[model samples]
Target: MSPRRIVSIYLPHFAIQRWRRRRFGPQTPSEPDPIVLAREGHHGPVIHGMNAAAVKLGIEHGARVTDMKTLVPHLQVEDAMLEADVRDLRMLSGWARRWCPWVRVDGKDGLLMDSAGADHLWGGEAAMLADIRQSFGKAGLTARAAVAPTIGAAWALARYSAEPQEICAEGEIAEALSLLPVAALRIDQDTITLLKRLGLKTIGALAAVPRASLARRFRHHLALDANPPKRLDLAMGAIPELLDAKLPDPPLRALRKLAEPIEDIDNYAQVLGVLLPDLAEQMDQRGLGARRLALTGFRVDGKTSTVEAATSTASRSTAHFAKLFESHLERLDCGFGFDAMMLEALVTEPLPQSQHSLSGKIEDGIDLPHLIDRLAARLSPEAVLRIVPQDSHIPERAERLIFAGSNTDAAWPAHTRLRPLRLLDRPEEAEVLYAVPEGPPAQMIWRRRTHRIVKSEGPERIAPEWWREKSQTRLRDYYRVEDSEGRRYWIYREGVPDDGRGGAPRWFVQGLDA
Candidate 1:
């Protein structure tokens, strides 16, 4: 294999430049004074980063905001926006793919590109560096680019060089870095301080000292090898890093690149019709079924639109996927026209082969799952719910509605007593007439109409458990009564007469059996 030739691009004013361009467009009048980004720091708010203008004006980074204001009164200060800077940095990385495909972000403010085989394509290393710097200048950014046989040498040279572009010859890396500061070795600040105190400030000075003497005097940890040239040789790939330039794993996906752009909904449906079967086949081969699916439309103009759907169960059926995709296809934006369509199974579950019985009806007891899946796709998953019994005695609190199929163990409890077919969520007040102190009402006035009781049964008492809650609950005596017109009503009295717990007992209509 060919030796790795890494290029490091350092953007020193990344944050400040990003903020300034956002504030003062592309054109700045004259010099536009100077600007510094200030953020909350260990010693209160301080200058975190600065632009070239600030640096030229003798303003330094990490200076306190108050002191900087005193030093340069007209200095424009803005709150630091690190997140936006990182996003722009990533975009710049994507742009750098024009030169090389293997690029990685180096620290927060710099990028490393493995330009081993790609330099010749851009007309050698010098032309590539010039192009990179010119691209940043066009984007209102200042950049320093360097190419070396080693990433460490490239990183140090890019930051420390006076010129915007630098190249270190293949075997002369040690000679090139020997005159630079001890910090070029990427050692700790404490070690650099100790080295300076010992009169060894440059890489060459440290290299001249005996290995045993250097190790014995300062036991401080450093990235030093037996000799600087030997380290350079190793870094230059005489011995390789365990794994360098590792790319992220691609997601589980399937794609269909159309011969022509598709715009109409019917055409999209036809494409999906062809793609779903292959996607299901892929899932089946992996012994997996998708629980969540995402459909993305890559437009002709380099823009993409996406829509996602989740299933009630892990499914590998093309019919199931087709139904789901059809339901949400209208929401996808077909900008220009779609050049390609991709369907990715974002979440999946292991599904083993199923055994079939030779019964007359293959799907015997529960096709309800398929029905639920259809409804959930047509509407929202949240819109379809299953009712399950909660452990409570109060009729309103006896059951709760939950997302369908979430709990496999959910079931309706068997009835201990007859409950009305229809129940008011909260009981409605009724005026009881001829209600004896301890007996059921003979008649009641509800909705401004009087109903005479023809027959009655039940004084089944239900009281609230006071330990679990602190609500205004009273003893309830429920009765199933049939009116004179033969309509059955579930009525209850809230309190006992003369029990003195609260006040006069009142009647409420809780449910209806008619």
Candidate 2:
């Protein structure tokens, strides 16, 4: 096996370049105007970072913005987004895994990759470094890259080397690092100052000092970077350094690049027919099924159109998934025709294999999940709803309407008493007349219509849930009553007369029994 090779990428103007890319486009060119990023400090706004233009004008990082304004009047200053910068850098490091599997974010504005035996894929170490620099340049970024046998040596060369791209051969770490300044060892500024004061300005000069003398000087320094000797050892491959690589999750998607742009729905459907089976096989290998899948068409004009399908239960059946997307195919707008297509499973669940009938017929009465999926695709997913029973005795809170595609195994509670076929969201108020205070209503007025009670059966009293309701909440006395026209209702009185919770009892029509 070849010796380990590490690549270090340094972005000197990462913050400023990221801000410019957001404000302008990714291919934005450098402007003559100076720009600086500032953050609120204890004293005032302090410069966090600056562009090349601002650096040439003598603006330094950590300098107060107010003092810098005195030197350059028309400076373009924006608030520093340090957190966003770090997040984007992390994302970029993950993306950098295209060059190698092992990639990590180094410090605040750099990336480290264990290229190792992967450089041959890109032609050589020189070509690999050039490709990295070119890729970053296309993204409107300035990148300085270096490759060496040791990560520490790669880091030093990437940041402090005169050339933007450097390749240090194996066994040449000492020769490459000797001419660099002591600051290139990544020590604290205070240590660099101390080294300069001791006539050890260069890394070579510092290395020539006796080990005993150098160890005695920095023996008490706890930080690894603070001790120049340790850093030197790490850079020279005397001590091994481990890289904490960022590994991204594997994407559950399949892609097809078309030889020609597909313009019609039939052609798109044909392509989808090919993609669904491929995607289903992938899910089958993992013993997983998709709950939601998205099919996206990449148009020749650099636009995308997506159509999504959701299953009532986890499913990997290619025919069923194809049928679900059939109703949604027309929704895709093929602007300038689609050059490529991709199908991705966004949400998934484990689906164990089950035995099928000998005749290949569904043993169950109906394929309700597949039927619901078709209906939801034909109409809207939101339009197809299922009433899920909630564990509440209150008529209004007894059940809820949810998307039919939701997976739930909650069964409706078995009740001895009959419940209304249709329950009102909120009880409508009613006025009772000619009825005893503690008895069923004799007559009731609701919605400006009067109803005489022809039959009545209930005075079932239900107490308020004390834990959930206020102590002053009243109890309910419900009655199942039939009016003169044979209309049935579930009505209730809010409180008993003189119960002390409120005044007279109020009546409400809570539901309609079928």
Candidate 3:
């Protein structure tokens, strides 16, 4: 049986590196100017992290911002988002799963992978480490990697080794670690200081000391890192440490390697026809359905073109999915023609099977999801929309436009009064002649036209939402009135006359009734 192997990936400057890639594009130039990340400290702002440039200038972490400003007048400072850094680190670890399945986050800025049987896939351990570093470099990250027979040894070597990519051969863990500093044991700084004071600075020197003497010195310590013997034992493989690997859900995807490169849209459609059914069969087996799907064509020149489609509801129907992609296949630029095709279900939901009608009759009503998918494919997704009622009393906030497929079943609030068929984007100011100060308008001039009120029905008063609006905000009184030509208008008064919120009440045309 082969011995267990572990790989440690250390990201020394994760925070600032991530900030630079996001602020500037991934192709950011290496400027010599120092950059530091600052966070709010109890004593005002302090340096949380720094880039390679700032490190060269001796600006260490936890330095006061005021002091650093005095030292380097041209230093660039950015607010540190530590929480976002941790999140992106987890995502980066997940992305590393392409190399090995058993991968987990080691600390705030490191990852540990059980690369026991996976190293052969990349030829050998050294080649795999090189590939890992090159991949991270391409993704705008500086990574150092090491592989050893134990997790502790790999962790120590990845961080403390002189070389960026190091591999410890089998049965050489102790010899490799003997020359490293006592800090490499992952112990506390106080223990390291004490060990150095006792003339035991190296792991080899510490190993020469009696275990009984070391235990007597650290017996009163409670923290995990305070025990150097346990850490040394773990690193030397005398004690066992298990890695808590992150296992992601299996993705629903199907791929086909083509025999020859084909650029025709019909050929692409044929490939998609086969891919969709395979995905549908996988979805059926799991009693699931896809809400979003992506079709990607890998070209001979090493580039890829992808077209995506989304449905109003979960569906596993191959015909429906194929129809959605059919119109989009023409949009793919084949370059040197596609050498492979892949179909992936990016989003899915549980969908149980339903019985079909025994009469063999066509189902009543429109297939709304299929229709929406087709329309969204033809026109842009933003071109199709559905207006859903919002939970607000303000007329303008009463309803909002969302993509057509979402919130299809949301119920509108029941109202005793009728609303207009069409509402204007914004209310237009109008001059009104009222019979009474608070009564509905008898005549009004709007949009440079006069309308004589023949019939009128409302004084529907709606108050501003106090929690969301300022206390000084005025209330509104909406009226539904019809002119002599039978054309109706929805008009509102901004405030009651002399109510003290503002000047005399102002009238405006809110919408046009059908």
Candidate 4:
């Protein structure tokens, strides 16, 4: 069970070390230019990545910002902060969970983790890759790491080895993946262009071909097994079956660490109300509850401020997460003063424990979930909404609004006619006036006002899910009419009654029945 190390890291100048720490901050400017990030492509701003002085001036990575400014005419470019490089790769995956709690990220500039059994608590695997490259060289960042026992041989020794850390031994993932390339078996680019037009270019030439013609010429099933103990147990570890289809990260977090640097926001709301009663007693001993939480403070000058809060269901209430962090604690930017706070539930559920009604009340409708958690903590979770039910028989695609306290049990569609209590968020193109395009319209103008119909019933037709979509729409009919100032509309007509598509069926109105 303990034989699966995995590290990987690799940042390859994650967007020029985040554009040289946002234009030189944690210092390093002795010779700067030659940057490049560009992005708008379709044949315009291409060069999506560069630096190491635009790769020593060859400037090639989908190169183009108009031919790299006609070949490094002092390059520099910029434009690709890629959402601040994915918010500094999720704050370096929350600072690599202080070293391994199975981190993963790995793409838009790598990070993989699973330092199995946690790299001997930071001392071996080359002293946890020299203390994670000295904490990414004090965060100006430029990591390269590799430790292997297979996350595809530590992502092929962290981007094909030049050793900023390498460690593979344990039947050496097929002699450290036989000198690399076959894109190190992370496969597909059409299997590395059909293994480079079949000269099988390395994973030791697809381990010398023939494992039933490498699974009938690349119908691949991991590491071309030409038998070296079945390609060393199918090439050591091509992502431990993608870390067993992911989802292990959240351990419901809490952290605190203050002792001093607090800068009163009521001492950060008295340390988040004494850390929400031990995070609501760890979500009430795991019957779980939280539905998105976050808090994170970390400040004393190295910036970190998160506040997040969302809920409509799962709730292990600590005065409902201190009224969901008192509506974003006055937008926390405690800058030079936080010294760590943390929280993190980031979504949880299962909350089971609610049977009490011998006249104590609560068969659902508890003050409308505390007035929708105080209007989603003072307005904004898409400003509150929530309809749900949508399999679509098209009454505006049969319901779905979502966002106000989400956790839907659904159940609302049972119409034997009469639906309009207030729908319209779109649907108001009326004008009709007809004398018989199949009866009932008698005066409709709407919004520019004309209405007369004094009482009409409906055509109520609907149709159009045509298995959800490929576009054809038209068949509607509906009508509930009632005008001459008695209001009540709901309209609809669209088409059908001579469905030969096109001309005169239009109408629309959709809702209003007070």
Candidate 5:
């Protein structure tokens, strides 16, 4: 075997750079700001939590927005978009696959590829590192590569040591990473700072101290040592694991349902609500958002149902999320009432937001959605439908009517959409008298109300769309007309005279009160 060349690729400046680009999205005025301060320091959009340019501008990871603003008076600070970041990380991971197949995404912003025999493809370790750097460089990414016997050492060297890429000979991981700071072990800030303050700064320093004392001083270090890839797989042994966990910048997840059955809809809702909200909060706490969610509802009756929906944008609001749940509730069947609902949100994306909540006037009203939910729960999801336009030429089928939650942005084409607020579920047949073929019904008796058409605008003929079975025998000449009461009516002739498709040339009141 050509040495197992485990490579760690890290993006030290991902969050900061992404924050800057989002803040400067296409339409910022020609302005001088803290970002300008970064530019002045010759920082080429490559700013990190600890880059000298960022430090000079006083931007620390845990620093407050007000303090950052004070540090760089013109600093254009931004809240992180964890959803977008995770998305980018996933894309980067797939892209990193070009480097090695045994690639495991590490934490939020790193990747570890088991290069092993693959390193020789680029001639050697040094050449491989160069190629990796060049590849990321072309993709507008700043990455640090390191090779080590163990994942931990490579993680430490890539992140902590600024020596670019560190390539260690096989089995030299402990020795190779010993000098790295305790922070290189990817511990929490308090632990790292505490270790440094206690003279336990480097990995070697921490390692040399009595294990009991070190464990006593920082219990987190012991816990970190015990962390594993899958949450269920807790680690054992003196596993000096990689300090970095490659988390996707884009979000995706798969979940399994539990054996227990959920009795109450509210109870079922409560567990999932608590779990999903808490998990999402953790993501938000980490500056992230989820754009898609999949819910797998398992019942005690050996039956399973799955519901999936994608958001037009990323979100974290519990209310907005409950709305997504409405889509799947019908299929859940409440079998033996549900045993469990395992929800997994994927296609995580960064939420687009401004600094403040746009500080606007608070609009007050009964939340119509809350009412809609109650109504939908009581009625057939399809019984009460909302009109949604499908992109097509057939008027009736041109728009689809679907359950009205999660999906509400249905727009109709203006040319064809002079639609009335109320349309009969099915057109109401009318007695019509027209002089010309396929012309407006001059006088029509609709719904027991006899009315004469004062004026008409269309013989706007719609030929039957042969592809659709329902529309195969239907042809209509739709007209928009106003009656004496100044009420507008949308009426259509179902069949034209002597047409091939056999049907009475019946008139119907399709829509009323445009």
Candidate 6:
């Protein structure tokens, strides 16, 4: 393995996954596709929406969240999740390591592997890369490769080679990379523009300039130094490739248009005639249909509104698109005028080949996901979620509400004790008129209501999860108390009784029964 030949992969715009689900849908009023902007973390980059639609209009990265909204009035921005990006990067790095032992992640989206000696193990570099590409083919991703002298030299060739989107050999590095700008070496943009103004359009052109003179004019003074013996442009092997893929476009596309822009939108019904045939043909060629459709509408002003509707059945017929978009496009405001509309089908999991037996009917039911999508289109996706518990003794941190579409791992933690459904956001305190020394409360006035405890079961003590910050720590004794009215309440008292420093014990209602 040549130690100097280093490989680096870059994922430009790596943060696009989290913002996959937008807030507004086709059933709602017309709106631009908003994105969440997340900070780069260990996982590479989290897609926090810097609305691609707004970005299409020329907003650059790191534009303040509020400023971005003002720049594009309809923009929706969110805090990028740093933690999630790190997790994703770590996973990608693990995948890269499968090809080579010395794999390291460049940034969120880039992976670098020193494939010098390892290429032979997979038959050869190009063949190895083909295998890599084939794996991504199944998973649906795109990649580019290059090879060169040093890791820096190889990186330059890989990023800017005319054949950058594919693999390059070591001997072919200099010729392939000669026409590339110095910025291809992963240098800053400002330096590249300055080099261009100085007539250094290519790496080869920049190599001929005198060191003393070049140093006086620009910061790339080191590139001109003649004393190093080795030339700055002494390129070697072709740099290996790095792959990048955005959302995979499924095989089929469906479109709908309006004859006349109408705010009432009776036109969406009338215009399904022309668009459905083209999509049906695509489904035939691809052998898939309308399991998922991303219905998009472009207004006269070039702003786009999209709604994705799905079906339980993999439908290739015109009726499916009509039924899906009927209610959805109705709410779409013509806003000046809607010029074009397109429906892109995606995530087309297999539909049944034919009717199944009666026993299959017992296992089969109407697609729950199709129903959920309908409900989400009418209501908010966040509204239709399941209660998931976290493994923490702190009442406030024990559970959280998360959107169902997020693919979040909100499983009921095996390490946690049973948590009640009615956890108070804050512990409520009350005056205890009568109580046992160590047993449950005998009589207490809570929420301004006086209650005489008939039966009490408790002493389920829970100590604070002190691994976290001291401010969040708690020591509590829980009790399930049954009062005369047949109402059972789950309550807990905080702080150990003997622990001093004037920390008074407080009582709280933790949860209620179903």
TM-score for each predicted model, relative to the true structure: 0.54, 0.55, 0.60, 0.31, 0.44, 0.48
How well is each residue in 1-514 modelled by candidate 1, as lDDT tens digits?
7777889899887877778787778786424578788989887889988877888888877789989999899998889988887888777777777888888787778889888888898899999999999988898788999988878788778987777889987887777777878777656666668778879888778778886776566454444532343343344456554315446444667799999998888888887887778778888887888888898999999999998877777878777778878878888898889999998999989877674466645466446666787788776778899778888888788887777857468567787778899888889999987555868789989999999998888898999878776566678889999999999999999888777677888899999992
Candidates in order have lDDT scores of 0.80, 0.90, 0.90, 0.76, 0.65, 0.60
lDDT order of candidates, best first?
Answer: 2, 3, 1, 4, 5, 6
Model 2, position 223, has a per-residue lDDT of 100
How far out, in Å, is residue 502 in model 2? 57
Considering TM-score, which of the candidate structures 3 and 6 is the better prediction for this target?
Answer: 3
Query: How many pairs of residues collide in each model?
Result: 0, 0, 0, 2, 28, 36
Q: Least lDDT summed over 10 consecutive residues: which range in candidate 1?
A: 225-234
- The list of candidate 6 runs beyond 4 A from truth reads 1-252, 255-266, 270-293, 296-324, 333-340, 345-366, 405-410, 413-421, 433-436
- The CA lDDT at 110 in model 4 is 81
Residue 81 Cα positional deviation in candidate 1, in Å, after optimal superposition: 1.6
Which digits, one per residue and each the tens of the lDDT, describe model 4 over residues 318-365? Answer: 887787678688788887799889887977978876665989776676
lDDT of 6 by residue, 190-270 (tens): 666766776778776766678666645544345422211123433432323333223223556656655665444666555
TM-score of the candidate numbered 3?
0.60
Best by TM-score: 3
In model 2, what is the error at residue 391, expressed in angstroms? Answer: 40
Candidate 1, residue 274: lDDT: 79
Mark the regions of model 3 whose C-alpha exceeds 4 Å error after superposition: 1-5, 12-91, 94-103, 114-148, 156-233, 242-275, 285-288, 292-309, 325-367, 378-380, 389-394, 407-419, 435-440, 453-477, 480-488, 495-505
RMSD of each: 12.4, 12.1, 7.8, 21.5, 18.9, 16.9
lDDT of 1 at 147: 89
What is the lDDT, from 0 to 100, of the residue 290 in candidate 2? 95
> How many clashes would you count in candidate 2?
0
